[model samples]
Target: MRYSTYFLGCRVNQAEIEFFEDKLLKLGFEPSKDGKADIIIFNTCAVTNKAEKESYRLIRKIFATNPSSKIFITGCIVPLNKSFINQVKERIVQDNEVLKKNVDNIYIIPSTQKEKVIEIIEKEIIDKPHFDSLEISPKFIQRSKYYIKVQDGCNHFCTFCIIPYTRGRSRSKPVEQVVNEIKDICKNIGNNSDFGAEITLTGICLGEYGLDINTSLAKLLKAIIPYIPENARVRLSSMDLITLDEELIEVMASSPKICKFLHLSLQSGSNRILKLMKRNYTIEQYLDIIDKLYKTIPDLGISTDIIVGFPTETEEDFNLTLEAAKKAKFHRIHIFPFSFRPYTFAYQKMRHIKIDHEKVKEFEKKLMILSLEQSKNFITERQGKEYDILVEEGGYGYTHNFIRIKTNVDKVNCFVKVKIDGIEEEKGNFAVAKGLVTLPV
Candidate 1:
């Protein structure tokens, strides 16, 4: 049977869906070139109100387009949307008696048991599967580089977040297991294509990687350094500022194999709002970490996540956030309007409070302007400097500090030294600088 999958979320969700794809491929199932397929897996995200609506809309579209196909819905939406889960079952199956008898075309898998989806397919869709004699690669097939999930779940119960409830407490894969996976992927290293070549270790909460395993991200990094391909580098998914420490900083600073970029989270800058949101850090603390990181790791590109127009966030609170962000000089800011999830602490305690939609838009625009300014400033400073960048498709690549550069280099999937020639004059969300490839590294 042919299969197709859809995922709408973060790098962790992408990695999970890729894992499912690899398994299906190994089982001799072909990918559907068209939308229609015998089996379709759709991974849902409930991180925001908009995302939740989009998930449902896509599910409806998929169902309508593929009337005869068996559909599987999984991810945060499946487990949390109790009424909607039943609504979908009733809407799809239409027979209460049939649902009670455990017969349905639509299957809803919980996020916790999402990895066991293949087992479900084996039992329900396929039996006595023929194994491929050729070895199936253990790395992610969707991209040129390896994307591994070293950890799952979040321990921090931040007020605005529903992840801790849906994903559960932090747990980590063993260091040895992670190292072996890295080694396995590097054994057959391929050229960089689109998305470039790099091993990005992703997780629900990246900095919480090693707390459960009595190890640390630093230790894990050291263990895998010898295994990473010499030409490729590694990048961490978003990290919590509170969890970053001197050890990890040292590991990052001392290694050329690690990307000189860190994506830290600073949800709110107001001290009071931060406490209310349970972010566990003040603006001062956040800046101090930034200062230390910049001083330690030269030319480090620091990006962050900021939620705007949160309920109870006064105009002064919003100003404070803007001020703090300006002071930090972020490489990029992911601006998100506050999304209220029903199971979160903020939803329960601050549901009555309302934020003006216009205010959210105003705040988001302000940050976008700041983001553009920062990108320009960052590129201007590195105007003539040469840096080694991993070249992918379309003659585009990103610097170690995460600046996208367009060049004339044709080599893909390898590192090349390039000098910044000029910046893209056109207006956009962020600036993409122009560079001249000196030589392939």
Candidate 2:
């Protein structure tokens, strides 16, 4: 049988979809790239109202375009919170509930029961390999970077986030299992230099990895580093400030394989807002960590996430955020207007101190503009510097420090030394660098 898989939300979702795709391919299922397939799997997202709306709209569009194809909806959107699902279902019931009429062809699996996807497929579509007979392999499609999910779920339920509820408690992959996965990908791809050189370790809460198993992310990275090939690099996904310890920073500092970039989720810079959001760290502590990271890692690319216009956020609080952003000197800032999610703490609290819609919009616009300015300044600072970049499709790639650059080099999935000359015109975010020459792996 032929199948197609799609996902929305963070890199963890991307990794999950990739895992499903790899497993299906191994189970003798062909991929349907272009039109209708025997099965279409949608790994959905419901992080925000916008995300939920997009998921429903996509589901309807897929059905409208391919009426006969069976649909499987999973991920954070389904079965996480029954009330949330019911609310979405109510909307579907009001309009065209496509799945209601064709119940046999549509399946809604919860995020917790994602492993059952293959089993459902076998029962509903076709039976091929026994569960025990499947041998997994890596098929890293986006450039030569392989994303390995080292952990699942989140224990920390920040008030504004619905992720912990959707994903459940945090659990980690065994260190040996993670090491073997990376080694297996390297071995399968061979020493061709065209693949298996960059591995991004992702999870819902990456720093919380190994806590349940009596180990830490530092220990896991230390164990895995030796197993990776000389040319291969490992990148950690986002982490909370509280979980980032001295040991982890030291490991990253000493290891050349670890990328010199860190993304921390600083939801709000105002300490009062942060406390209300239930974020554990203070602005002082966050800035201290940033200072420590800079001192430890030279030319570090520090990126962050900022939430604007939260409930009870006053102009003074916003000014504090703006000042904090300037003080942090973030390499990149992701500005998100506070999204009121149903069943979240922030949603309920919003009723008491909701900011005006126009003011919120103004805050969003201001933060976004500041983010762009910060990004441009960061890229400008890197001008005339030589760095190694893994060339990707369309001659675009990113440096080890996470600076996006476009080069004239025609090759894909190869390392090249680039000298940043200036920022790319019209393409405001990244730099326009001159390709010096191809670098040996």
Candidate 2 regions off by >4 Å?
A: 82-94, 97-99, 128-143, 194-196, 426-441
The candidate that wins on TM-score is: 2
- Model 1 alpha-carbon miss at residue 316, Å: 0.9
Q: Tens digit of lDDT per residue, candidate 2, span 309-339? A: 7888989999898888888888677777777
TM-score of candidate 1 versus the correct structure, residues matched by position: 0.92
* Candidate 1 error regions (>4 Å): 80-103, 129-137, 140-143, 190-196, 425-427
RMSD of 2: 2.4
Please state the error at residue 59 of candidate 2 in Å. Answer: 1.2
lDDT of 1 by residue, 1-441 (tens): 899999998888887777778888877789999988988999888888898889877877787777667788888776544555676555444444533344357788877777557776876788755343223346535355667888888888899987876677889989887887777777657433333468889999889888987999999999999877666789888989989988999999999999999989888789988998888888999999898899999889988889997888888998999899888889788888997896799899888898798988998998899888988888989999998887778878888789999888876767788999879653555788899878777
Which is the leading candidate under lDDT?
Answer: 1
Clash count for candidate 1 is 2
How big is the positional error of residue 67 in model 1, measured in Å on the Cα after superposition? Answer: 2.0
